[model samples]
Target chain A: MLKIKVKLVDGKISKKEMVLNKKEVTVQDILDILEINRETVLIRKKNELITEEEILDNGDEIEILRVISGG
Target chain B: MDKSPKCSRCGKKAIIDIRYREEKLCRRCFLKFFEKRVHRNIEKNKMIKPGDRVAVALSGGKDSTLTLYILKEMLNKVKCELFAVTVDEGIKGYRDKAIEFAKRNTKELDLTHIIVSFKEIFGYTLNEIVEKNKVLRGARGPCTFCGVFRRRALNILSRELKASKVATGHNLDDESQTYLMNFFRGDIESSLKMNCDESISELFVKRIKPLSTTPEREIAAYALVKGIPFHMDECPYAQEGMRNVVRVHMNKIESTFAGSRENFYYFMNEIIKHLKTKEKMKFKLSSCILCGEPSSKEICKVCELLKIIRG
Candidate 1:
């Protein structure tokens, strides 16, 4: 098994040594691993919103944004 | 069930009936006082006129929908041509629900509705634009996208519908929240712009918020009374840190003071008046370089967004 680390640059949180067979994974799996709530968070892959079922390949930058409220 | 017998805002026994079946406000004192405040503000500003084509910017939210309902009823007393325009940002499940409710309410009210979609005209929804634009996250807020496009879309549609002036559902709570936010941010000029005075900039379509005198609780009650189809679930994005903090702070202040809403209006008014004297709040109007619409800069916000995304 190959090991890959997940890093959230904006929030400065890092996860190290995650095992994966392939170079790609689904967005939902990623969120599950990160323990983020999809309903409260908006994930953008390649600048477009990605549903949980969609797949993300290696080198694909992702953004996890918390929805802003108020005026 | 003996209903919850208290005012949501003050936590006192609702001495009035602000909403039927709900312990909103009492009839004798609070109701009369609140309604009279609205009437006084309307009369002082002279917001409505006979034979004027008033295009209401309805968002299917409690505020805008209630604005339409009240303005329509107000027009019965003073005859005016009232219609509604809704700009669909094409936010998939979110905006589609709003447009449906807006359309349904307009039909029920016997008012004309004009629906415009970003996809139909601009070849992209907000979803599409966000997908394409690299500078979306840190560079611009959601309002930067929604507010910019929606303003132009509403103005263009209203002009096509031959509206003399445009009306929005900006209520006192909304205005007060904005004022507090601006004051904290130290954005004096932007705060001045948020002022809902009668004579607005004439470069684009003139906009007014007649409900600026009405509280959010009152508007929500009015919407419920009219049976308007409004979405109550707050948007998912509403929990963003900075704005949510501000909202919580304002809510605390509002609860502490009975006339907090009215005070916000007067405070902003004083700021606007002072800014105007110093020429700091004087609006600069120029034709949009692309669309020839009235704008502060050579290019309008819509054109700027298009250029940024299309590039």
Candidate 2:
């Protein structure tokens, strides 16, 4: 099992720990697991900003931020 | 990646790492930096004057919400008053929620909030327009109708509110995308002449973009950090294919090249400045025959689109 910490920046969710059955997961997979819209949020891991294709490792701390686009 | 980086200003744990500048910033420092940059943009451009009533084109999105919040803080030092004008395009699920957020934000800030709807002004909601145009003319996508009408609505509302300047939340990304989109479409003239300076037409409000220099990501982060409530829902008709392609390409380039976005922005500004000096690009404005608003063409885009919808 992989232990990862996820923090939601939009105040929708509190910082929590997610135990994953896989050792690695893509950012989209995490969004799917959390039921967050892909286009609505950006993912960041540690000090680096991440894209949907970025892979996460065990014990990683990820931050999901809601993005606003021009109307 | 450095798991823990110190803020460049102070040794506090940094919340964000700005790779473009090779600096890390904590939440407090980041907010300070953001506000300072916004103030600099406004001051350098002379966007607002003392005793000027500035109307913020608030859409209840993160960018517009942050624009209103920062402008309110910055304008407090001056004698200007801030008001929010929200346009309800009559988007069923999306706009309804956003207007609610806009109302809440404006009420909390103690600013006068005005809501204008397409149904009241144009005699048809966006949905109705789309529905009618689909059968009549297979109307150009919803964005085409929405953008033209929304702009006119904002201008009219600003005038009615007696606002001297209208501020929008367009950030660096939006501007850059638009610039590139026009470039790609071979419509360099539109990009060059687009909002380079305030309009002389009395019907058009002097528009300002306080967040023009800020990136959309930074605006989003600031909105979240400041606890500003904004609806994150995107418009259902926002799938403008070419613009989206340009946006993604620009984001990819910016990610790889760091300051590429700002470089493009500055490059475009220089070109616009050079063009402005080379020739006087002026349009003789005429009142729209139908609505009596300022228009370069005889009928104006709003009247033209309305004709299509009503027919």
Candidate 3:
């Protein structure tokens, strides 16, 4: 199991910890597991921006920054 | 088997794969690609020119911050005077934090920053207006009020400052969503003004969106990569807007259909060319009797909203 800390950096700053059973998980997989829209956010790990296909390691501290401003 | 894509330009580890452009770019190459695209958009659209005084609508968000930073880079090439205008709608915790970010960016760039508030202009903060408006059920969402007032506030200040253009941080996602929303709502007539290079009215300043061709996620990524400080905190009242519904759907459509957003924009842009030539499509612009601001009706939306809030 992989221990991942997901941070949502938007109007409300909140964190969700996920313990995944998969041996390999991409950022897209994390977004899928978290049910986050890939179009509306940029994912980051270790303060570096990452792409959707970037694989996640155990104990990854991931930040999701919402890019949507309004309607 | 390493499935990771490398930079198509330099063969370095790619930070992003722009599927729409069929290019995988590293951090260094991506920045160049982004700025070059933005510069090209501004030039192709004739959004800016030498000796132009531009007022940037800086909300301290990722989009606006990227717009400001990019325009700041154009000081030499474009030879334009730039200033930042931030609308403080008085959302307490939310807007206050954003204003600090706005101030910091302007200070760092040595640019003028002006903050206009709902309290000062309308005698009631957005929070206060929402509180008072609670008496009437389904009166309106905070966005309706904020959008009308903020646009008015930005317009009034930009014109007063003698700016040639008001540069907003509206990225491709926003424009594409708007294009789709208007289409879905059958409000094509309202968007007819979009293709007009001419100022609709002297009272209404020309608005330029250099980032309108760029996607929102890419802007956020650029900001993050460049270490640009921005307050990405969502406005608490944001979810109440109708655009929230469309944005979700638009994002879904774009993700499923890569390049769909840009295609929508281009299609809409071309459609407007044919539509604008129709006699029935033209709307005459006139000044609001009460405030002497440009309006199609006797009263502008700002004054009308103020009347309701004041009452």
Candidate 4:
């Protein structure tokens, strides 16, 4: 199980915890599993930017910020 | 992510992994790189000249805010003046928050900020125009009206403020999406004329895009990293536009292929350059007969659209 927090554009935290049966999962892999477009969100761990392929250990908390700017 | 936490330059804790360069950078180094790239772009493109007044079309979004912030930072080095203008299309609950952010940023920077509304310019807010457009026999999307009106409003306000150049926060993503949108629409003329590499008129203020090479993701990251307060909510009518469709697909392609945005930019630039030389397409600029606005033809599209909306 990996802890994921979804942050909306308005800066609000939307809880979205994910539980997978696999023992090892990368950031990109989980995002892919969740069907989140990699380009549409920024992934961060411990308040620092992390790329998509970073491996996630069980109980590791991450924040995925939604990025949408259309005019 | 290879779990590298050290900045490529300083060995500090990394804040971003720039996939294009295949390098990870700390906050300080990332910001330095971002500013340097923007400054280099401005210098290389000759986008700004000494004694020139630049009016930024600030929407308070990440892209425009970063544009204004970077340009303002370059004031001492570039020998230019800067102000900001915000065009309010009067979309309820959408534009109001953005304008507030625009006002806040300008206030903080101590720069002059001007805002013009669609109601004042066209006698109709965007909401009203959309409502009226709905009952009409045949009408374009709200984006069509908003786009035309916003461009006109930006031009008028920038000119009135005695701006020598108008700067918008259109980044690489927006530019590529626009090109793809036109290409998909089968609008070859628009694609060819996208850059306006030559044949610019002296009548209207020249438009500049300093952030053309920077990706939208970088802009958003810069805003957050710098603690720059910005309005992040998208416009309500954005999802209804075809550009949104193109944007989604382009992003998907970008994800699958890192640095594809810049690649598209380089590829497209070469094509546009070759097309301009081979076709000898000199788009002569003319003033609109009714409104005296700069147009490619006798009457501007804004005026033509206004006629339909006012009827």
Q: Where does candidate 2 clash, by residue pair? A: none
What TM-score does candidate 4 reach? 0.92
lDDT, candidate 2, B1-311, per-residue tens:
63355788897766665657777687888888988899999999988889999999999988889889888887658888899999999989889989899999999999999999998888889998888978896638888888889999999999999999989999988888888888878876677556657475777788899998998878877776677888886678776546766766676676567888898998998887777776565444678888889887789889888777777
Name the better of 2 and 4 by DockQ.
4
What is candidate 1's lDDT per residue for B31-74, written digit by digit as tens? Answer: 45555766676668778788889999988887788778778878
Tell me the docking grade of candidate 2: incorrect
Ranking by DockQ: 3, 4, 2, 1
DockQ for every prediction shown: 0.04, 0.18, 0.54, 0.46
On TM-score, the candidate that comes out on top is 3
Instruction: Tell me how far the alpha carbon of residue B204 in candidate 4 is from the true structure, in angstroms, after superposition.
Output: 1.8
Order of candidate numbers by lDDT, starting with the best? 3, 4, 2, 1
Expressed as tens digits, the lDDT of each residue in A1-71 for candidate 2 is 88878998763557989888986677778888987654346667764455555567788899887674322
Candidate number of the best DockQ: 3
Clashing pairs in 4: A53-B1, A54-B1
For model 4, fnat equals 0.41
CA error at residue B82 for candidate 1, angstroms = 0.7
For model 4, residues B187-302, the per-residue Cα lDDT tens digits are: 76777756664546656677889999888888888888888999987788888899888888888887778888789888988887777776466566788999888888789889
**Per model, how many backbone clashes are there?**
10, 0, 1, 2
**Alpha-carbon DockQ of candidate 4:** 0.46
* Native contacts recovered, each model: 0.07, 0.09, 0.61, 0.41
